[model samples]
Target chain A: MTQEKPTVVLLTADGVPEPADLAEVRDLTDVRVCTAGTLADTLPGAEILLVWDIFSGALSDAWHAADSLRWIHVAAAGVDALLFDELRESDVLVTNARGVFDGPIAEYVLACVLAHDKRLHETEAFQRAGQWRHRETIRVAGRRALVVGTGGIGRATARLLRAVGMDVRGAGRRERDDDEDFGHVVDSADLAAHLREVDHLVMVAPLTEATRGMLGAPELAALPDGAHVINVGRGELVDQDALTAELATGRLSAHLDVVVVEPLPVGDPLWTLEGAHISPHMSGDVEGWRDTLSAQFLTHLRTWLGGDEPAPAVDKGRGYVSG
Target chain B: MTQEKPTVVLLTADGVPEPADLAEVRDLTDVRVCTAGTLADTLPGAEILLVWDIFSGALSDAWHAADSLRWIHVAAAGVDALLFDELRESDVLVTNARGVFDGPIAEYVLACVLAHDKRLHETEAFQRAGQWRHRETIRVAGRRALVVGTGGIGRATARLLRAVGMDVRGAGRRERDDDEDFGHVVDSADLAAHLREVDHLVMVAPLTEATRGMLGAPELAALPDGAHVINVGRGELVDQDALTAELATGRLSAHLDVVVVEPLPVGDPLWTLEGAHISPHMSGDVEGWRDTLSAQFLTHLRTWLGGDEPAPAVDKGRGYVSG
Candidate 1:
């Protein structure tokens, strides 16, 4: 006899299945799709929670109603926004869409690095003004890059940067002399000590209590003059005020995919800063990414349905996927 | 026993040695620096000509005075502008700053490709407007690129693009399956037939009778809609009028570092086109490039003075550095 399908609460941004894969997911499980407004009402007795909206913190607010939430699967690489104290203390297992983002995010980071070195932004601006100003550009090859975070995304970034001949290093929770991706991994706690030699400071670390505001004024100040800071992780991973001040002086540049505030408040200094390059939190969301994320979630859902745990379980205490 | 230093005519844009190396070249040899207007006077008895101004076609006008010319070392890669019927038929040896430009131009092309794929121009535009509009981006890794020329710059471009996981092919003078840089090389004579599948059509071919205006209406029309054309070679390699028309329609985009007109004239439609990215022919002119080029010429000069042939001599008949 076939057992009854477990109910799945899918917290989506628009309360609709965007890609066809999400609809297919509905056929396999008792799926109840809802937006943030209806998340609390839909949470009770659902054995599985799929955080498709990604950055929504609705789950934390509706935690009192999670009567049977045995598993929570976030369709994103970072679990910072979704994790809460109550959920971390709970027995519920958390899994994230990890491998799906590695390649796209790494490619984005490399693109930013190349664009900065080649002065593409200036080229675009000059094109707009009909100016044919010729200028010298820096080479990406042999330049030093320090990737903060030793997770899948950071490792992928390191490999891609190294592939193009950039000298790559990493900063993680612990220091290491031998890392396959980053030849020498420095401790993130001591990030300022190593910033002096970095040409590109790439922040891809997951935002946790330990990593929040990790690149504060001290670390930003420690970076060499004319350094480029690329943040594809989270806005909280950096001190935005400090970065803005540095960029204002034209001593440093930044390619920020995330900001401290979503929709970045009107008249914000970063939007007008000459050295700041802002994108709308899309370092990893390449074309067909929604479909890929949904497919990844389905793979994990299937494994869970077959009486097996998902492959990459997030370390609740650490607040990310731990190797 | 001291040997007499060669009389070198250095055709410069500003008639000054901007880099100190050129000043050093003056001390070592009988160096005569002259601008375009004074080239004819300076060319009379010079045994060696250093075309440091790069794109100046003044040599053709001064050919009547090239009585003692034996070797010409261009400080730039493309020798199309400097090559004349008289020079090609004469015994003058031509060498270029070939290896110096290969890597920098390759890096620039990759930068343009990545910038185009990631919608960096749009991101900059959005930031200027202080709008945080999120958009999906194309992934460069799985995309297909067709690099025209198969010379040093083309080979370097192919390698760099492939390093970022792009599917690369080459369009050269002839078709070959066993080519090292590009596994499969297509003949440029059949360029139109092969362009339909290409996502990025990179033009790095040397400008010759066979290559000038090679990518005309037919080739541009054959490209898939929304395809990007990147030209780091001589602008004559493509039909700019046809490109402008295609770019106007938004059916195709372009990253043009070299234009048919250097300053691109006032009120030129290309400058205002939405899809046209224009740079001032400075793709390969990276930081300290002048020093590198000067050092290369000095090395070649030393080799020639020691009674040895300078390496990688340009095939004057074909108008570029050749195998």
Candidate 2:
């Protein structure tokens, strides 16, 4: 007697899980691809859901139809988009593409830190106008960095920064002494005190009730003058208005890869803020990222098929992976 | 019996030797501060000359006036300005501020590498225009780098790049196996072959008979498409016209901290090149650099005054420190 293969519904947007990527998991599971519009119709008999479009609200909109869904894998490091009341109350296991983003995001953080210190933007402007101006740049070595979060991405970022001679301090949910990269780990509650001494404040924390709006006017005010804020974490982690105000006054600078609202509206003042370097939420995306995401999900599929639990399971209540 | 102090001539431009810096050496020698216009008058009785204006041609023009000059120290890494026939032929010892520039220039080179790979310039433009554009950036880690010159600056640059996980190779006047930072060290003659395989071709070699105009059309053409040329060495090391032509066609890019004619004439096409990042010749200068330069020279002064030879003595023929 042959065992039936589980049906996996790939919910995507703008053609994610391209044909080649879908082929990786197609042999093991009966697969169906659907968009936000057709997700409800496709979710009826699927026991597994690959939420490739983590930005879409279709997962919550179509939760009633996911009667057979036992597991949900978000093709993103953060799973905030899929934590609706019904999904949170259900007994479904949720996992995210954690390790895939660690290296690329760490690289992006370093790039931003170095760029801010060197004033590359000013150099480029001078180049464009045929003007030659000499300016002294700050040294990155021996500078202080505070990485807010101690997860895989945060640890990876801390290690890269430390490798280049930065004095890195990490802030997480609780203090831990076993970390190799962070010179010191402190409770997230003590972040404000640490902010005053850091030259670079890197945000790589997951979005949760406790972390959301963590960096507001008070936190921004506590940072030392000329400190650069680099956010690769979710947008809500920082208060956009407070950041803009600080940037406008030139008291602080920021390299924001993600914002509270992405595709940040055309008129958003944060875009034109004097020291703000904005990118449209693509820090972790390296070449052929779609393939990597598919491969990550395939690894979990294989583990689940062999009667083993898929790793990096998120705590639905906390909205992140907990120890 | 009283010992007469040596007369030291300090040649400067634009107020370089600030009063505080001059005070460091004033009590040790009979010091005469002069500019390019007044250098000839001051050179007549000086036993030591501090060439603070490394870019000035005054040293060559006023060489005939030097009657007692025994030692000439240039407050710069390169000694090209004082490499005149008269100075080279005389028994005058020439030394440079070599170790002083190595660390700062290396940091600048790393900054350029990170900025170029991350396209920070483009991100800035997008930010200025209030456009939220998301683009995938190339990873610097595991990328190949060919640093030309194995001296202090080049070795420091190689170390920083390697720290960031780059595969770094060093090219010097001769092959060496003892370098810890470089994976392989090759002769400068083989640079063209290596350029084709590297992502960053960093020029940190001193200006010398063998290295001047080294990176011309043929050498630039040998580099793989999209390779960046970072020159903290000297302006003449690269052929400006050839580099400009390559940058104009968008096949190559460059971050030139030094140019053949610096304070690069306002109308040079190199300034407007599509992928050019230009800064005036101040890459090695950080905060309190003048003070540091003065201190470095003072250290050597005490050694020379005590009848000991000052270090980092340049070989007149090769124009750099010889082991």
Candidate 3:
């Protein structure tokens, strides 16, 4: 006799997978798709939850209704959105889509670094004006880069930077010996000191209590003048006002893929900042991203149903994968 | 007990070093700086010629006046400016500033590839317009690139592109086995076949009968649709009309640092082509480049004065340093 299928709740928002795309998961589970408005109504008695709408706060708002929820799989690398007090204290397991974004995000970070050093923006402006002004461009080799965060994305970024002949250093929660890509992995407490030496500062750390607002006034001040800041991680990891002030004075440059507010207000000062390269928060996104996310969730679901531990299990207390 | 120093004529244009900057070379030779109008007057008796003005056609115009000229050192990489039949048939040894631009040009090529793949131009446009449009970007890693030319600049470009995770193949005068950076090396005759497989085609070959007008309509048509063309070699190496036509139809894109009529006429269709990223011929220029050129020439001058063959002796027949 076949075992009975368990209830699987899929929380979705714009650009995520449709019910038809999740037919693979539906074959093994009783799938119920929910939007922000219907999440609370469908959360009760669900054994599994796929947080496809990572930006939605519905999961936290309806946490009390998750009486039968045993596992939560986020369709993103970050778990900050689902790391509530109740979930942190519960026995429910959390898994994230980790490996899918490493290569694409790392490529994006390197692209920003190259564009800034090569003065591509100025070149484009000259092209548009039909002016020919020749200028010297900086070399990427032998430059120093400090990657904040030692996760998959951070390691990938460090590797690519190093491959292009850069001296790369990484920072994690605690101090460790050199890894394959980074020369040394220092403790987060020493980020300020490292900031002074690097030409580029890349923020790829997760959004947690210890990291939110990490690059406020003092930390931003520690960076050498003319240093570029690249943030592909959470928006709240930096203080927007302080960053704006620094950029306005032309003391520092920034390539921000995320801002404190998504769909940044039309009137925000960042849009007009000469030193900023702002893009909508889509750094890790590549073609067929939705299909990739759905496939990753299905792999985890198959393992979870077979009573085997799924890979990339996140530590609720630590807010990331431990190893 | 002392011998008379050789007369060294310095040809200069816009960004070339001034007489004061050539003091080191002056200490070893009787230095005579000349512009276009004065070049004919100074060319008669000079034993050495420093072609700082690579864009000037003065060398070819006054070749008959070079009675005592034994050697010519060009301040630029390409020797197209000096490749007159009279010089090619004469005994004057030619040398060029070869190593100086290898790294800078390679970095520029990689920068353009990254900018194109990451859609940085679109991102900047969105930032300027204060529009928050989220779009998926292309990843650079594992993409194919065809780097034309097997010389220092082409080799350097292949290395940097490969370092960024590209599957790089190089095309030269003839086919060869895989080198350190390029996985396969094809002959220029087979470039059309290779063009169909690559996402990026970087042209860094020197201007010569073998390479001039290489990327004409037939070759451009062979490239995969949406493939990006990067030209840093010389303007004449590509057919501008063919490239502009392809770009107009949105079938291909280009990052041209060199153009047929640079300071590309204000009304040129290329400037208005949405797919073209046009810039002045400044791919190899960097800060303190003039100083670097002077130093390189000084080093070569010292070797020439000692009667030992100065390094980087160019083969007049081939128009570049041959192994």
Candidate 4:
């Protein structure tokens, strides 16, 4: 008996959008690509679902009814969305887009931090206006940085920041065995404590019930005055209202690539915060970006076809667990 | 017999407009703080001559006659002005504040690359006017960078660029034994070869007779079209006229900390280069910057006084050497 080409559904509003890359994967022709953004719409027909942009909701009802939906490939680095109580009981396989944007996201964080500290905007304006304003700039070397979340993005960011002579620290849910080598690695509980002392705070933590609103009013308060922030993490990890108020007072300056109300709404107060720079949620997306995402999907698909379990068989309880 | 307290001179027209830090250094109660508008008037009565704003031609005569002048410390990073033939032969000790700016300068290079590629100006304006624009940004990772003059400043820039996954190549006057471990290492002779292939060019070399007008018509033409330049190096290292012409046509964008004419003469056409950014030469001067310069001098002074050679001793022929 021969095995059949697995039925696959490319869910979410945007999934790589590269026809050339996906052409080879058409062996599974019943491939349904609905820009159905919500889990409710995407989970019904998917024997294997490919989710890119995740919303914080459960698709338990759809998963329960679908007899064929056994696998889920998250198109993001974090998998907090599908790790609900409903999916924990099922034998559904889960995978994530791990190494795709590590370099690009790390590059973005560095660009923003350097731009802010060196006062590039002012320097640029001076050039445009033909003025000679020689203001001193803050140096990144010998400074301290605290990166929340220790997944691929956080690790890449830490490495980049450290190479520039920044004292970099990484924090995760639990301490890693080789934590000492990556600077001051801290457990989740110590995030607030670390915030107070860091020169720059970079948030890359995934959004989960436990991690949501992690950098709230109290966390913002703990940070030292003038602490710079670069958030490439999910918007929910930081409280938008709290961040706006904090930035308004000039106590802190932030380069936020993620926001609670993305598209920033119209006339959103976040747009008015002088210290807060909204990047339309684009720190990870770069040229040749779609090609990289599609490549990750192929690797996982090939493994499943070879009768080998995916290396990152998503632990439904922990969402996309990094095993 | 006890040694005399080291004589020190503060050699700028108007800085801090006060001599507070100079008071901290030993001996030389007769501090010659020359506020000479013209270099021709710099006095002849000093044991140590510090040149901050004064020119090389004006001091060339004085340095030849001042037998007691044992050392000349350049307040700036590049010591090309102080590295004349007469001074080189006189056995006068020379030193510069090299490491003081490794981080800030490296930060500047990274900022300009991102600014041009990410379209930061348009983005900032849009965000300020409460408009959200989703313009695509060029990814900095996986690009090639050639950092000329592998001293503290160039090395620092390389480390930062490499952190973000750029293929960082360093060019020193000569190759060292350990050059292989640090990306692609080339000698200054191979600069033209490196420039042709590089996407980003960072010049951190000190001004020398050989290096002056180094990046002239031949060099600029060699660079791939649209290649970006960041010059924290001396202005003469890049031909101002050639660079201005190149920038006017919009093929090149330059971030200049030092220009051929410092404070850039009011009527100079270099001012009009739309792509050229003038920062009033502040890449090395940060707030609390005096302390850093003072501290480095004192640390070296400790070693100089203790019968050990300074770690970053000036190469009399080559100006400031890498530490």
Would you list the C-alpha lDDT of every candidate in the order shown?
Answer: 0.91, 0.86, 0.88, 0.73
> What ranking emerges by lDDT with the best candidate at the front?
1, 3, 2, 4
Residue B115's C-alpha lDDT in candidate 3?
Answer: 91
lDDT (Cα, tens digit) per residue for candidate 2, span A209-281: 8998889999999998999999999999999999999999999999999999888987888877678888889
Tens digit of per-residue lDDT, candidate 2, span B149-187: 888899899998998889999998878777787868988
Mind giving the per-residue lDDT tens digits that candidate 3 earns over A1-323?
97889999999986665744587888899999888888889989999999898787788889879999999998889998888999999999999988889989998999899898889998888877777787877877888899999899999999988888888999888777757767788887656766888799999998899999888888899999889999999889999999999999999999999999898887889999899899898889887777888888898888998898788689888898877
**Candidate 2 similarity to native, TM-score:** 0.97
lDDT per residue as tens, model 1, B27-111: 6789897888998999887899988888788999989999999999998888888888899999999999888989999999999
Tell me each candidate's TM-score. Answer: 0.98, 0.97, 0.97, 0.86
In candidate 1, position B40 carries an lDDT of 92
Scoring model 1 with DockQ, what do you get?
A: 0.87
- Candidate 3, residue A226: the lDDT equals 85
In model 2, which residue pairs have backbone atoms overlapping below 3 Å?
A: none
**Distance (Å) between predicted and true CA of B196, model 4?**
2.3
Provide the global lDDT of candidate 2 against the true structure: 0.86
Pick the TM-score winner.
1
What lDDT does candidate 3 reach at residue A241?
96
TM-score of chain A of each: 0.97, 0.96, 0.97, 0.89
State candidate 3's TM-score: 0.97
The segments of candidate 2 whose C-alpha lies over 4 angstroms from its true place after superposition are A15-19, A176-178, B17-19, B176-178
* TM-score of each model's chain B: 0.96, 0.97, 0.97, 0.85
